[model samples]
Structure formats: structure tokens, C-alpha cells
Target: MNTVTRPRILVVGAGFAGVECVRRLERKLSPDEADVTLVTPFAYQLYLPLLPQVASGVLTPQSIAVSLRRSKKYRTRIIPGGAIGVDLKSKVCVIRTITDEIINEPYDYIVLAPGSITRTFDIPGLTEHAFGMKTLAEAAYIRDHVISQLDLADASQDPAERAARLQFVVVGGGYAGTETAACLQKLTHAAVKRYPRIDPSLIKWHLIDIAPKLMPELGDKLGHSAQEILRRRGIDVSLGVSIEKAGPEEVTFTDGRVIPTRTLIWTAGVVASPLIATLGAETVRGRLAVTAEMTLPGQDGVFALGDSAAVPDKAKDDDSAICPPTAQHAMRQGKVVADNVIATLRGQALKPYVHKDLGLVVDLGGTDAVSKPLGIELRGLPAQFAARGYHWAALRTNVAKVRVATNWTLNAIAGDDFVRTGFQARKPAKLKDFEYTDAYLTPEQVRKQVEGTRALDQ
Candidate 1:
């Protein structure tokens, strides 16, 4: 008697792309047809757009982290590990588990969607001094750190020290930077009221960016409106400027203005995951090169998407255009890739990925927001509605939606309590502490390690 073997599918990452791909595969494929496995460090899908709100105390981390086990309908095996390297020739992925154990996972079909890391330049003292807004831990840490600053400043009698502690600087003019500045400024503004000894004027927030304009995608009028709102709220908006150097107590700008501060939030940009480079495949700007169908050319049974893949944009006539790394594109590409994977498995023709732009939404905290949903520009309350509405709709689970909506309602009515959680006192949460970019193995190292492991197994 002959037995049939199920095809093994491995998906890396738990972000917008990987999660969506797993969900689609679980729904479309039968248990006997394919055995699906997901490799990620965390078990939840992080709704990254709401991370600023988490830092601002408008929403809790759990509210945005959709659990992988929430639905019992799917039977995908979850591996609590991050893929550090992949040996394309051997069809083996090297993963570092949460327990620090290195294991090689073999797959018949693989999906690479490990997402991105915060892009940093070779600026002096930047990594050691600055904080990032990329992860859930970072958001929670920032909240506690901000409140700790207020607590320390209130206790200090020295004028210069208090002023330095109160001063905050945010670098980057993109969506993450803009929203982080707006939300955190609101947090500090409201938090200052609790400290009777501290003067509100001493608390200063400076937002600087190398770009000439803020959120250039928001169009001229809407972008200007956003800038006006931030400026009116007392945030010092500096355009075409960036940090020249950073230190423990002060940051010097490129224009030679030095400001003393304990807090420096770096939200400049993100590059594709380091795991992409370990494949030794062709890449476009650090992202793996993939066809319009989301498949790796010349590599059978492999697909890549999300922030880690430079998927060709078929919506444009120019072959040079690739899909921008955004949650919208990631989510849509996941479904397309899953469908294509299934098509390949069943010996059916695969379809190319094509989608129209859905516009963008930037929530400026409080009632101010800017959005251009479906090409219609809006600002203020209407834009706020659209922004929040879009995010609310984007939540993958009903439980997440309820929690977020409830958080919004409670935050509006009860307001932030401005309590310090003592996270900084336990351990420092600097840029170096969060992202483990140094953990990745080089392509040669990966091949050597895999070969050694295979020899041992044999």
C-alpha cells in the first residue's frame, strides 16, 4: 500500500503579510492537503499603525496585538522563533527560538515576510542615545520612560536639569514620526498638569526631519494643515533639518543648534529585514526581488512579500515601479501569494498581484487628523473619523476591534492617568536593546552551519 505525504508550508513573520497569508491558507487548504507552520518570535499580529497610541497611553499593547490562537478553526502550528537565515539550495531555514536554541526547519514551500527594521545611519552616538518606535516593547517602554522623565523632572530642584529632562526631540517627518510626536506631545502636555512643581513651559518638543515637507504623501494642503495643527499645539516643527550628533544629555542639529534632552525618539525609516540578505538573492534596496506574481524567479516553491520583498507593481506601466512597503500592500499581497501558492500546489495557473492605491491616513492624536481615502483629501474631524475608521476596520479580529473601540471611548471620557510603570528603572530600553540586528548569520556562515548540522544528522 502506498501513502500520500502532505506538502509542508512554512511562513516567516507574524506581521500584516504573514498573518494574512496563514489565515488564507488555513481557510483554503485542507488538513490532509498541506501541513502549515508559522515561524515568528511573537504569537500575535501587531497592528503597527496604533503603536503611537500605545506610547501615548491612548491604547494598551494587548489591544493592538491580535492573538494567533484566538480562532480555534485553524490548525496551523506556531513556532515561537525568528528565522535568522535560509539555505535556498537545501530548502532549509535556520531559526533561533525564544529559548535561544538554533534549529533548521525544512519546507516544501516557503513564504518570506519577515517585515523590516528601523533604518539607521552612521551618525555618532545615535544608536546608544536614541529610542525607537518599531516594536510593542518599545512603545510600552517609551510610555513608561516618558512618565519617568516627568517624575524625575518634578523631583529635581536644578533648573537646567529639569529643562533638559523635559525637552523631547523626534526625528523623521513620515507617518510614524508625525503621529508619534503628536501623540506623545499630548501625553506630556496632559501629564504635566499632575506635577504642581513643574512648569508646563519647560516641557519642549522639537520635531525635525531631513525632508523639505512633512508627510509629502498627504498633498500640499492637508500636509500644511497637519503642520499647522502641530505648531499650534506648541511643537517646534523644523523642516530640512536632522541630527548631526547625539549624546546622553544633548543633541546637536545639522544647523548647529544644540538642545539638551533625555528623550530622543528615532522614527526615520525602515529597511527590509536582515534575513532577506542571508538568502544571497538579488534585492532592490535591501528587499528581496520578486515577480509580479510574488514568486522568486528561478527559485521553485518559494514566495516573498511584505516589507521584505520588492514585488513589482503591475498597477503601473513602468517595469521599474515596485510596490511600496506598506500595510495595505502587505495585506493584499498575502492573499495573492497564498492563492498563487495553492494554485501552484494544485497544478493550476497562478495569477499576478494587482491592486489600486487605497490612499493614506495620518492620525495626529486628539481630534486632529489628515487623510486621503480613495483620492479625496480631508482634514480635522472628518479626517479623524476616516483615519480611526480605517484602522478600526483593519483590525483582524472582533475581540481586537472591541478592545480598541472601548479603549478609545474610555480614553476620551476618563483621560490618561499619567502614571509611571517603572520600566526604565528595571532596565534601559535604548535602540540597541530592542532590535537584534546583530543576531543574523552571514550567507557563508549560514551555509556552513547548515552543512555541519546535516552532516551530524547523517
Candidate 2:
């Protein structure tokens, strides 16, 4: 809230893109050039690629979260909240603090990097019964839930209840789904070893996806190899199938198969944050549309990036081919956006964002993994090494890197502690209601609702 003559730069969201943008700006800009403020729901940058590792108990939740204050060099004022509304015409952004207090602040430059949320479908009982794996809290909840499920199954006398508790179903064939299934399966495998009364063979892990291949983004060859690895570990890989319904103790698949399962993890996909819709800007697939330079066309001093922005992939020839919303692209786009912002401020030319695909690595827990680096395909332990090392290098700070590395080493040496955190004690939250909205209404809609209620009372 400094009244310096320098322009104020307000960056929203602390995901890979926003965090990197702030980091670059702090390095490039002089102290007196501009005042940078970053608003996020959390105080850390989540290494999303390794989120499954956290759920599987392979790494502590904090291992994947880099403290924004420490890594950001204190150059940027970190506001712990999300931007609720933005008045682009007035250059004012209304942010809701963590305490649920709304504060309006005017900004000279606005960067919308508010990341995507879980893309849920209208499957029956899904919202009421299934779990979601998107944040550190969710992942931690999953770890505890899985381990507790095993414990509950062992203690239960009813055969049907035990079966339901033992069967785990994960929907989505993307990296998040596959890794969550793989890592949690490994955790269960290890935890069951400690439970002498539990039968490992009776426990079932079913990965259901509408796609024909697991990890389709990793290409067909590596995808097949990854599936084989999971199948070898006694996992049921159901491709070209989707969950038609879910219940507290059962799930029915679109393939006409019914299975008993207490744990239904939904990692299907992501859509842009509701914040993007509030922008009142043209969007592609729910993401704000941005130019090759990551700027909102005709919206001066406004920039957007990450999963929330549908930026053109200049590496591709077709103008319609927008960049895929991935952490890789987001991290790269952040630096580009920062440079472009600086360029504009200095009256210099702007550069376009462009990067070729470097292939992908899918970690399948333990020594099993599949990867394509620089178009070179790899599998098994080598792939796992590549996957972990890739994420380690991609993390924002050395402290985070060391912490993640140390956690991995400890896990290897000490083995997994299959204790449940009991965080999932509450009833399953509806998928559509995951964002924790107060009135479950937008800023504009809430005012109308309040006014209508007041008139009715009068």
C-alpha cells in the first residue's frame, strides 16, 4: 500500500507461473522501479508434478511446497488470499483475505495467473461420495484415508464392507491419476505388510479412464509400458472406460461393470478458475485468451498466464493450437511474461513465448516409471530417476530441492509409515463446491441475492 510514484504490479496466484514471474521481476527490476505484490491462497508454490508423491507418503507435503517469502527474496509482498473480483476499467482488484475480509486495491499492472481447479463431471453420486486430489491438503487426506481404509477393513466383520474398503478406484488417465494410483498402491502394498490380518491379494486397485491409454499425453508407446508396469503390480487398468456412478460403498463404470469401493479418487482434469469467467474476456476452454506475448489484447497493462490463460503455442504452426495447460509451459511462460512486462515498461520490444516439447516422465511409484526426454523413450528405474530428478530440478529453490531429496532418501531408508492422518473425517465434499465459496455466488450475484433477501424481509 506504499504511495510510491512507481507503478504497482499485482500478480495473482502463486502457482508455477505467478511465482516464477515474481522471481524474475525481483531479479530484473530495481528496488525503486516498481512495487510488486502477489496474492495467493497459500504462502507457497506447489510442485504439482510431485503431488501424487505426497499422497502416496513418498514425500511430506511440505517437501513439494516452496515458501514464497523465502524463495521470493522478500521483494514481493505476499498477500494470503485470492482475487475475488477485478474491475479492469478502474484498475482495481478486490481480493478476499484468508480471514474472509474483502479489500480493494488499485494496481497499475495486473497479472492473472489464478490456476485451474478440478474439472468435475455430472456423474451420479460422484460429488457426494468421491475424493479429489488437487492440493497438498487433498493429497495428505488421501494418504491417511488409504491407510485408514486398510485398518478399517481389517477390523470390520462384514465381508461386503471389508471388500468395499479394500477396493480403491481412481478415475483419469493423466499423469495425476496414474501417479496417484501407482503411489497409493505402493503405500497400500507396504502398509499391508505391517497388517498380518490383512490379505494383500484381496485388495484391488482399479484405474478407470475414458481414454484408451493411460497417460495419453506421454505418447502411446510409453503409455503402454506404464500400463504394463501397473498390471504387473496386480493393478486393474481399465482403459476406454469411465465411472458412470459412485456411492459410499460402490461405483458403477460406463463399461457396465459394478465394483465395491470406499475410495473413489477423481483427478479427471482441470478447468480455469471461476476468476477467469469474471474477467468478462474472451476465453478458450474456460481459460483467458492471451496473445503470443502473454498479454491480453486491447487490455493494456493486463497480462495472464498459466493454466488460466489460453496462450498461443508459437512453437506450433496452427494459430488454433493453444499451448497445453501444463506445469512445464506455465513455468516457461512466467519468465517470458516477466521479461515482456519489463520490456513494455522500458519502451522496448516484447518477445513471444515459445518452447518445444521436451517429452514427459510418468512416475509409477517404486522403481517403475516411463519417460520421453528429448524424444528418447525410457522405462523402469531409469525412467523413475528421470522423473524424480526432473521435478527436483524444476523446483523453485535449493531449499525445496534439498528437502525433497532428503525426504526421498529417508523414504528409501526408513520405509513408509502407513499411519492415517484422519483429515478426511468430514463427509465427502461436492466436487462443484470444492472452492469454499461463502454464498456459493459470484460478487455480482451475491449483491443481488442480499438485496432480494432484504426486500423479502421488509
Candidate 3:
């Protein structure tokens, strides 16, 4: 191995944690100190909370995609690709770039924050039929798909076909599924007016989940309030039931009822990135087990955080309790990890990750909303105001904040045009297509890649 000169720092992923880590590193580290590089499939940090709005045409894709290059403070090297594997012993990361070129990148210190993927179950035809809401492309494609359904239903002469096209099902009643159902239902409710041939009464949006309660974290009263809001909007909210089987034309629910619909959105939960498995490390329910300091236990110069790491919550005083995978926690965890990385370089003490819960927000696509900011419950416009206010403040950049604010203002005043972008037309829109489940390399493959690169070097 060549003698080390300046320390090389590499951060994986572009989600809240990875982006914030890179930003803070660039801000804190001097030019002559350490060279920082970021590896990600996209160059933007997606604001996940507002993705339902994107799919419903309330916000443009760029409005929620916070660009990493927009940083005026420091310029970190960008590798436009997704990381596949890493060899901690050799300090090398295997990456598949935009052009599919496989390159081995070496680093002195590496941060693994590759984020999570859309969690799906073993239900039949789930991947083939359901659509995801994780990425910007998926969100945009869903908008087109929903609009196309309306058009197809309007032009169909067959009664069964029209009914199938107009009926939509969204699984998982948590924040993602509930908000998605609410926003998209509102879309169809408004857009059907433009379809003079189609009867608005035929339009149906059902939100279902296996859990007994909807957003139980919001407390009973607030959860019920949110459920009432959706119910009043004509949404069929079903609980304690899930999909028994998913088919192209219909879905059989666990409650022994079959619903005919062409659209199925899956937003149940998330699992850590498949890259986590390549490390062959101990995982807590699929997430890499990490200390309170967010470091890989017993692995020097390696770190993990975000949704991919099971970081113990020091403030909670519970050993089994780990920090929940939320954007708020991820963002704060990123800064702490960055500081620790800097401290490691300076031979200083490492601090554990700890913080109080800032609460949760669920925007139901209008003045109807619910929030629990710092244990205080809110509902209706007060909750809406509190929710949006909190999100607007949490946005990392001024430009992102302005774009989001403008989109909200325009969406409210002018309303959605109900026009499809058509960019995703002729494209396969399904869960299997969007989730890169098979992208990661095996542990042996990671070792081979690094070894092969070293052989060529020698």
C-alpha cells in the first residue's frame, strides 16, 4: 500500500444524513485538511415529506429535490453513481457510476449512510402491480399514471373497465400512505370535473393498512381527527387489514374482500439499503448495529447512520431503544457524525448521538392536517400551519425553502392544471422497476473488486 498523505473522507448516499454530513464537512474542514467525496445515484437530497405532493401535482419535482451542488460554502467532490460495496480492511468502496463503470475508491475514513428502500412483503404480484413513492422519478411517474387512468376511464365504453380505471387503492395508513391517498384523492376529485363523460361518483380512493390504528403515534384523539378528515373527504379508510394477494386487475384483501382496481400504491415501510448486507456485520432487524457515536463497533475509521444504522438513543435511557428513522433524526445525526469524524481526525473525544423528539407532522394535502410538535397536539388549520411552518424552517437551503413556498402558494391560488408531464410515458411503472433491490454486490465480490484493483496497481 502507498504511504498516506492527506486523509480522504468518502460519504455514501444523498439522503438527509449523507447530504448534511457532506455539507458540514465541507463547511468545517479546510481545503488543505481532508478531501471529501460524496457517492450517490442522484445529486440531490430529496425532501421525502413532500413527495406525496409531488405525485399529486401540488409541487414540482425540482421543488423537493434539494441540489447538493447548490452549496456556496464549500465544494465537495461528487461521484454521480450508486455505491455497491465496501471493504473496510482495504478502505475501498466499489461504485457503479452513471455509465455503469465499476471503480474502486479508496478512503481514510468512510461514512455509510446509504438510506433505505421501499419495504414490500411477500404478497403475490405486489412488485409487479404496485407503485412506489420513494424517488423523484417514481413520484413523477405516479402522477402520469394516475392522470392516464382518468383519461382511460373517460374514453372506455365498458362499465367494468371504467370502474376498474377509476378505482384506486393505497396500502399502508401511516404518514406516507394516508397523505398519498389524501392528496391523490383530491386530485381525482378535482380532475374528474374536466372529464365530462366520466361520472365523478364512480371515483373511489381506499386507504388500507394491517395496523388497527392509523398513525398511532399521533395519539388517539389526533389520529381519530385525521381519520375523520379523510373519511369526510369520501376516502374509504380501512384498518386491521392488508392485501392477501395483488393481481393486475384486482386485489384480495385479508378481510376476504376483493377490490377491482388498476392502481395500487405500496408505502408500508422501509428497510435499510441492500448495501448494508455487503458488510457482513451484525444488523438489528436489517439495519447495521452501531454505537451511540454512530460508529461501526470495533471497526476503525468506519461509520454508519441514518435509516441504515441502528443507532442507540442515549437520551431515552433505554438500551434496546434506537433512534427512529425520521428525517429530523437523520439530519441531526448527520451533523453529529460529521463532528465526530472531524474529532477523530483531530484525536479528540467522540460524542454520542442524543436528542429529544421534535414530534411528527402529517400534511393531508390541504388545510386539513395534524401535528404533535413537542408533545402539544394540534388539529385542522392550526396543525396545518404548525406542520408547514416546521417543515419550511427545517429545509436546508434558502432556495429550496423559496421554491417550496412558491409551489404551495401557486398550488393554492391557481390550483393544479391537472396535466400529465408524459415524460414517464411508455415506461414501466412498478415496484420492481423503481427499487434497485439487486444492485448491491456480495461480500466476496467487494473483496475481489478491491483486490483486483490493487493487483492492477501493483
**lDDT of every predicted structure (CA atoms):** 0.94, 0.85, 0.92
- Ranked candidates (lDDT, high to low): 1, 3, 2
Residue-by-residue lDDT tens digits, candidate 2, 1-458: 77649989999999989988998999999989999999988989899999999998889888898888774357798788888777776677777888987666679899889888888888889877878887888888778788889888999989888888999999998989988999999989888988888888989999988987788777778888888989988889998899888887889999899998888999998898888766678999889998999999989899999999999998888979998888899999999999988988889999999998777988887788999988889998888889888988998788889999999999989999977767757645445446553312365753444455447769
Per-residue lDDT of model 3, residues 328-419, tens digit only: 99999999999999999999999999998989999998788999999999998999999899888988889999999999999999987788
- The numbered model that scores best in TM-score is 1
Number of backbone collisions per candidate: 0, 0, 0
lDDT of 1 by residue, 293-372 (tens): 99999999999999999999998998899998899999999999999999999999999999988999999988999999
How far does residue 365 in candidate 2 sit from its true spot (Å)?
1.1
Off by over 4 Å in 1: 1-3
